[model samples]
Target chain A: MAVLFGGVACLALAGGVGVIASRRPVHSVLALLLVLGSLAVDYLLLDAQFIAVLQLIIYAGAIVVLFVFVIMLLHARSGEVARVPAVLPPAAAIPVCAVFGLMLLVVLTGAAIAPAAVGPAFGTVQEVGRALFSRFLLPFEAASIVLLIGMIGAVVLGKRLPPSPPDAGRPAEGPGEGRSKRRVELR
Target chain B: MSTADLVLVGPELVLTIAAVVVLLQDAWATGGVLEPQTPRPAAVWGSLAAVGLALVWDVGGRRWGPAFGGMYVRDQFTMIADLAALAAAGLGILLSSAYLPRVRLPAGEYHALLLLATVGAMVMAASGSLITLFLGLEILSFSLYVLAAIARRSRRSLEAGLKYLLLGAFATAFFAYGIALIFGATGSIDLREIGAARPSRLLGAGIALLTVGLAFEGALVPFHAWAPDVYEGAPLPVTAFMSVVAKVGAFAGLLRVFPLALAHLAGVWGPMLAAIAVVTMILGNLAALFQTNLKRLLAYSGIAHAGYLMIGVAAGGPAGTWSVLFYLLVYVAMNLGAFGVLLLLARQGMEADRVEDLAGLSGRAPWAAAALVLFLVSLAGLPLTAGFIAKLYLFRAALGAHQPVPALVGVLTSVVSVYYYLRVASAALSGGAPQAVAVLRNRLVGAALVLATAGVLWLGLFPAGFTAAVQQAARQAAAAVR
Candidate 1:
């Protein structure tokens, strides 16, 4: 069990590192998808099925797909620079991960983990559901509202552009035609 | 569910309702006018009305705590901070009125989001429970995510919004993980419970992570990469609002949550915060020195100011909390006034964000130039401006707690910040070239400036009333400590 848990954690860490280090935007996004999926698996390993499912549904399925679609739509010419400039990426990323790793280490070292109870107990779907519908109801509702807002926002901001002008249907043959086409397009 | 609970949360409810109404109004205004009608400034009026209602609620009460099943609380400190946040929102609306119309961005959603964000900040300040805190933080952050990219046609705006969203979600995850740890440690999410509980290892780790999350939101160094891009990309007024009001909410949350739950673990977290404060201040100021863009410079300045405010948090005492409240109030006033000028100068469809954009501003627009001077001086912590007194008091409080390192870093950053602050001032004062046609011609904006400038000058010169109110609020916050 420990080995399984540790392997899942290692896979998550590697996936995350790949997401950060990958040179291609598409590859980085794919890596992110993996990392997010790995996180859900980790949640399952920890016995939090509800959280694992929510993680899959919300982050991995919805958000990552949206990211990929946007990346595809906003694609540059095939060989264009896909990575952010140095001092920009590392300056933002390294400290965040370092602090996260250190903090996780602290939490793990400090926490005296409860010995595994072999039966279904805490962190099960039933326990999570009970908590969600009762003690955590308010936060759950609040989160739902937040998610709703995010959905509405995405729709509003991501309005697809209308079909291009009729003039755009035809290619300009040369500079003179292009100038006339531009003028026609402006009108 | 008595009326008193509702009354205690009157300001928050009023602002929330106003946000909804404003959003509805915006939808109505722009929905039927299919041909992109001239921007009807519904956002501006709604923002003003919302702020007015918030002020009424703020002035209506000066009492404290556990008002609604321990969800919300209100006191003098919160009252003052709420007023400041609302006032900043109001100015932001006024500035955006003049600013957005030029760019032809829709205004209603913008205004509604601003009000909701303010409500979130105020709620955060009044939060007595973890549920309220989380709700308030999400409200503030989500609204900001949209507002940061209101000019969606601009690539910079889209990029800023995306970056803020990514980092913000990451920060929220950290916050949630910390909350989970704390719940595991104490079996309760109430701030009062967390405060009274002793420093178990789980709780300590929770506090550390929570601090990190809040620090990131607050834009302290090492966690502040998103700030410059977002601030520079956002509308000048929205950027100003993000810098000031959002910081108010974040600090209020930190001030209340930290001292209450983690005071016993100060040995663990205090030095961590102090180091963060130092790095944030120095990095913010040093980075600002090389910026040619006015908005980017102010973004860095905002970061430095955040570091200064963190001094009070590092102190981890009642006095420290009071000083933070006072500084936030002053900061709101000064930053709003500064952005007012930027809004004034920002020509439509032009990058009015660069330092060169301000060349000879004084010769062309004396009133705006003077307002800019006042704001710049205050930002530099010059005497007779509110920032100076706020810093003095905050440093004194930190020293009182024997945390001199943050104070020292704060002073050094303050000195370093003076150069950039004055460079902008001198740019405005140079009067070599004719300024672009000024955009801030509206009387409402003028009124905002008058009010904000008065608050800055008055708070700097005579902060007794503000400080006294803050002290009372600090007392109430500490009441939950035991």
Candidate 2:
């Protein structure tokens, strides 16, 4: 069990390092996918099977795909220089990882953890449903409102601008000058 | 879900419904918000009416509880903060109606989105559960992101929106991670339970990260890079709305959580917050000294005020908490009023943003020039305006709570800020050549300034009644502590 945990942890760390270090946005997105996937695996190992599956389905599948779609939509030029070096020397990474591992050890061991706090029924859909509908009902409903507002705002921003005189659009192409001009025109 | 929950959430529910009504009405209205034939006043009226309705539910009142299984609460602080948030939203709508057409933004959608943001802020003011707080914060954030760019034709507007979206999402992620860690530590999301939980290193780290997220929303230094540009680039009314509403919402939530439940761990977070307050004040004021544009100057001033408000948060008690609320009332009025005066000065051909535009203001428009001076003096925290009394009470609270250094910094920074604020005021005094064209004076905006000016003097000159009322509210909010 310990060996499997160590392997998964190493993979997760490596995936994280790839995310920031990658030169391409697409590669960074893929790195994010890897890290998220490894995190799901970690969740499964901890027996929060529902969270593990949800994390994979929601974050790895849906969110990452959405990110890819947005990147494509923007048509941003590719292959920008990496802001930081692609990778650090093993000497540096090793000590940083050691410090991180030490912090984890302290958090995991210094705090008391209850052994077998729940049974196999834990993390089931029905259990989550019960909790959501009962104790967490207000927040659950509030989340819906947040999502609804986000949808409306997205539409407001994304909708096609109403057709105006062709000459009106040309001068407004550059933002800084357009801003001052529009500021006055909005009168 | 339950009647009690309904009662606790009644104000936010009304605001949300009003938002939807405004949006639907916008779609149904003829010609849309900008066309010459379209009547765009419904959304603005509806938004204001909604604020009035919400205030009717709890105006000058107080209630307390762990609503919805400890997910929400109502108290004096919530009442004070919610009223302030609603007032800011109402004023924004009033100020935007005439300005929107001048800028060619669709009136209906802009008002609807502004209402939605208000709902979010109201939620933030009352949230007792961490989940609810996150949702509330996001609702406010998403709406503002769109509103910042509502003037879609402007490159700067779009850039401001995009920058806000990116930086805001980054801040939200930090906040979410902090929530996750906090959940891990307490094994529960109930704020009271989390407070009762032990002070683990994990919880401490979680709180520090959470403060960073909230700090960004409040525009504290280091997290405030977005303010100057975004404020200058976005529409003046939108900038005014954001500066007032966002600070009210974010600081209200910060006060609710940190001072009430997390006070036990003050040893962990207090000093860190105090350090943040000092740096934020110094940087914000010093930077304001160099600004050439009035919008950018006010943005920096907003940042400095955030720092002063934080002094109360660092103090962490009933006196400190209520003092912050009083100061927010003062801030909402003065900040928006300053922008209101600017909005009136806007011309069909010029934005009136440059410092030189105000140079001959006294000669060009005496009333506006006077109003501008009133707002600037108040902003400078001089006596005879609410800003002075606000500073007085705020720093005193900080001192009463034993945070002497931050309070002292607040005093010094106000002194530094006076130099720049006065420079703007002097433009009105210099009375340069008279304007070629008459200044545009939208009645609604003019009324907003007059009202704000009245509020500033009333609060400063005769603060006794309002102070007592807020003190009563603060005393009730303290019940959450035990």
RMSDs, each prediction?
Answer: 6.2, 4.1
Prediction 1 TM-score vs. true = 0.83
Best by lDDT: 2
Expressed as tens digits, the lDDT of each residue in B1-482 for candidate 1 is 56776678777777767777876777786772211336665667766876887787687765555575666767776787787788778777876675665555556667767887887788778777777787888888998998787665455666678899999998888888888888878777888788777667778777777776777779987789999888877766678889887898899889878665567767677787888888889899999999988888888998998889888988887888889989888898898889888776644345467777788888877887898899999999988889899999989998999998888888888888889999999998995754453444777678778888898889988899878888877886676656
Q: Over the stretch B156-192, how does candidate 2's per-residue lDDT look in tens digits? A: 7877989998999988997898888788778877778
**Accuracy of chain B in candidate 2 (TM-score):** 0.96
Error of 2 at B394 (Å): 1.1
Worst 10 residues of 2 chain B by lDDT: B30-39
**Global lDDT of each model?**
0.77, 0.80
Docking class of 1: incorrect
Per-candidate DockQ versus the true complex? 0.17, 0.35
